[model samples]
Target: MTQFEALFDGRSFAAILFDMDGTLLSSIEAAERVWTRWAAQFGIDARTFLHGIHGQRAVDSVRQLNIPGVDPVAEAHAITLAEIEDVEGVHPIPGAREFVSTLPEGRWAIVTSAPRALAVRRLAAAGLKPPSVFITAEDIPRGKPDPACYQLAARQLGWTADDCVVFEDAAAGIRAGEAAGAPVVVITATHQRPMDTRHPTYVDYNALGATIRPDGRLQIRSQSTRKI
Candidate 1:
C-alpha cells in the first residue's frame, strides 16, 4: 500500500480541471444502466462491459466494443440519449459542490467526455452550477488518453496546462492530465481496484480537508491514500 497527498497544500495551481462523471458527479449507476443494457443485447457479461467503459468516450468505447454487427454510431447515440434522459442515480460527489463553488471564477472548469447537453443535465440534477466555460466531448478533437480535451480546457481558461491541477477518477483521464502537462489528482470513486496511475489519489473531495484560506487560496490537509 502506498500513500500520498494531492496538490492541495495551498500550492500555486492557478486553475483546476475536473472530469464530470466519476470525478465531480457520482453518475456510475446511470452509466451502468446504459452499458449493461448494451451488454445484454450483445450477449456479453455485464460486469466486463461496464469495466471496459469507464472514463472512456462513448463513441470510442462503442467502437472498441465492436459488438459484432453493432453500428458504433447508432449504439453511441442510443446510449447517450438514454443517459441524458435518466437521472435516477445521478448526484454530485460528496464535497464536490462545496469545494468547487469556493474556486474563483475562471479558476475551475469541467472537461468531460459527455456531450454538452448531457453534462448540463447532470450538473443541474446534482444542484451544481456549471462553470461559464465547460468543455464536452463534442468540443474536443479527441478524447481522454489523447490530452486534447485537457489542453483545450487550459486554453479556454487562458492558462497553460502546467498552471492547472486536474482532478479525475479514471485511467484515461489520468493519462490525459499527465499528457497535458498538469499534475493529476485521482479520485477513487470509479476504480474499485487500485488505480493504474502513480499520481496522488484521494477518496473524494471531502478527503481534501479543504478550506478556503483568508488569502483566497485553498488550504488542504488530508491523509488520503490509494493501494496503488
Candidate 2:
C-alpha cells in the first residue's frame, strides 16, 4: 500500500478524466433495475447477461448481444429511456462529491457510456454538477474497451493522454484508460466483489484529496480526514 501511495504522493498531472456512473456515483441499483427488466422482456438471463456489459454503451452492448428479431438501436433507445426514468436509488459514491468539488474547472472531464440527456439526468439525481467537458455516447462512435473515448477526453482538455490520469470503476473503462496511455485508478465504490486488477484501488474518495500546483498541474494526495 505504501508503494501504491508513492505513485501519486507527489506526482502532478495535466488533467483528470472520470467515468460518471460507477466512479463518481453509485447508479448500479437504478441501472440494474431497468436492465433486469429489459432482460426479462427479451427472455435473457439478467444475471448472466449483465455480468459482461458494464462500462459499455447501451447500443454497443445491444448490438453485441444480437438478440433475434431485436433491432439493436431501437432496443438500446428503449433501455436508455427506462434508465432515464428511474433514478430512485441513485446517489453519489462516498467522498466522491468532495473529491470532485476540489477539482478546478476545465482540469477535469467526465467520459460516460450514457447518452447526453441520461448523463445529465443521472448527475443531477446524484447531486453532482456536470463538468464543462463531458464526453458521452453520442460524442463517440465507439465505447469503452476502446481507447478513443479516453483519448478524445484528454484532447478535449487540451492535454495528451500521457499527461492525464483516469479514474474508472469498471473493467472496460480501466482497459480503455490503459490503452489510451494514461495511468488508471480503480474505484471500487460499486463493486459487488473484489476485482482483479493491478491498478491502485480506492473504495471511495474519503482518503483522497487533490490540489492545483502553482504550475497548474493537478496534484493528487491522500488524506486522513473525511468531509461530509
Candidate 3:
C-alpha cells in the first residue's frame, strides 16, 4: 500500500479530534479582514503578524505582542465579536462535509481556538454540523500549543489523548497534539505553500474516508498518492 493508504493500517482510534478553522473549513478571508483591521488599529503590520496568530488563542496571540497599553483580553473579545459578525467567505474545505458525515456520531469532536459562539457561527456558515463533543476556547484554560484543549476533548469523548487522532493544520496545533500524545494528521488546506512536517499530510479531505470496523474500531483510509 502507498504511504498515504498505510497511514492508519493495523491501527484503530477511539476518537478523532479536529481543529476547526483550517482543518475542516476555510475562514481565511473573513479572519484576515478582521485581523488586518485590528492590527491597523494597533499600528501593527497585519501581514507579518498573521503568521504567528493562527492556531493560538486570540488573547495568547495578542498578549505575546506585549503592545503597550493594550488589554489582550479586551482586544481578543473585540476580535471575536468582529469575526462572529463577518461570515463572508466562510466555507468548508474540500470534502470536509462528506468526510465528516462518514464518521460515527459521538465519536468525534472539534477542538478549536475560537470561542464557542464563533465556532458555532463558522460551522453553520460552512454548512457543517457541530459535533457532540465540541471543545472551544471558553471550555479550556489554555489553547493550542498547550495541549489542554486536546486533552480535554479526548477526556470528554471517554478516551485518552493517545487513543485519539488529532487533525490539525497549524504549527501550534501540531505541537499541542504531539504534547497530548495523539498522532496528528496535518491538513494543508489553508497553507499558501507546502509545509515541512513529519506527520502524514493531506491537501484536503477529498482523498480520505473513515469506517467503523465490525470490531467497533474506526479505520481511516486514504487513496491519494500524496507524500506522507
Candidate 4:
C-alpha cells in the first residue's frame, strides 16, 4: 500500500524510545561479516546464528547457542571488541537522522542490545550522535522481548510506558515495546517486515512527521496502515 501521507493518531507521549541496530543504524553487513566469521570458527550456520541473535544481548545469544567450550561473557566481550573495530558499512537507515533530529531535545532516547562501547562506536561510525539517555546491553539486566530495557529507558527519561512511544524493527524489540506498555508503536522495515506483522509499519523514518501539540506533546502523524 503506497500513499503520499497517513495519519498516526497517537502522540500523547512525553518521550520516544528507539531500538538501535535495525531501527536506526544500517549495520547488517558489518554484523554479518563479524558473525559469519565467528560462526565459521564454531562450525555454526551463519544464517541461523545471526537470525537467533537478532535483538538479543550478545552474551544472551552466546548462551542460547550453547556452544561448548565457549565462555559466553568472554565471547560476547570479544565480539563487541571486534564489532567496535568493524566500523565499515555502518550508516543510518534512510530518513533516520532527519526524523530523529526533529525530535525535541531530551524527549527521546536509544535502547539497544549492543554493549555501550559497541553502540557508541556504531553511532559514531554511522555519524549519528547517541542521545542524552542511552540504555545499552551493559546497562540492561535483560535484553529486548523482556521489556526491561524499554521500561528502563522511559523511567530514566522521567516518563512512563504510555508517556513514550517505541520505534522498533525486530520482533524482539516490538515485543519489548509492547510489554513496556508503550501507547504508540512504529515498526520500521529496516531489516524486514514479517508476513504476519501486526503493527503500524514504515519503510523508514520518513513515513513519520511530528508537530508539537498545544499541550506540548508531539503529534506524531504517519501514513495510515500502509506497508512501507
For every model in order, what is the number of clashing pairs? 0, 0, 0, 3
lDDT of 1 by residue, 1-228 (tens): 334433444465667899998899888888888788877877887886677687878989888876778888788888889988887888888888888877777778899988888889988988889897799989977888899898888899888887888889888888899999998888886566875667787777775654555765444456555443
- Per-residue alpha-carbon lDDT of model 2 for 48-167, expressed as tens digits? 878666798998888888899999899999999999999999999999999989998999999999999999999999899989899999999889989999999999999998899999
Off by over 4 Å in 3: none
Q: What CA root-mean-square deviation does each model show from the true structure?
A: 2.7, 2.7, 1.3, 2.6
Which pairs of residues collide in candidate 3? none
Best prediction by lDDT: 3
The stretch of ten residues in a row with the least summed lDDT in candidate 3 is 1-10
Q: Summarize candidate 3's per-residue lDDT along 45-129 as a digit string, tens digits.
A: 9998888888988999899989999999999999999999999999999999999898988899999999999999999999999
What's the lDDT for candidate 1? 0.80
Question: Candidate 2: RMSD over Cα atoms?
Answer: 2.7
Scanning candidate 4 in windows of ten residues, the lowest lDDT window is 2-11
Q: Which scores greater on TM-score, model 2 or model 4?
A: 2
Q: Which residue runs of candidate 4 sit more than 4 Å off their true CA positions? A: 1-7, 184-186, 192-195, 223-225
Best by TM-score: 3
Q: lDDT of each structure?
A: 0.80, 0.89, 0.91, 0.80
Model 2: CA > 4 A from native: 1-3, 224-228
TM-scores for candidates 1 onward, in order: 0.88, 0.95, 0.96, 0.91
Model 2 residue 94 lDDT score = 94
Return the candidate ranking by TM-score, descending: 3, 2, 4, 1
What stretches of model 1 exceed 4 Å from their correct place?
1-10, 209-228
Clashing pairs in 1: none
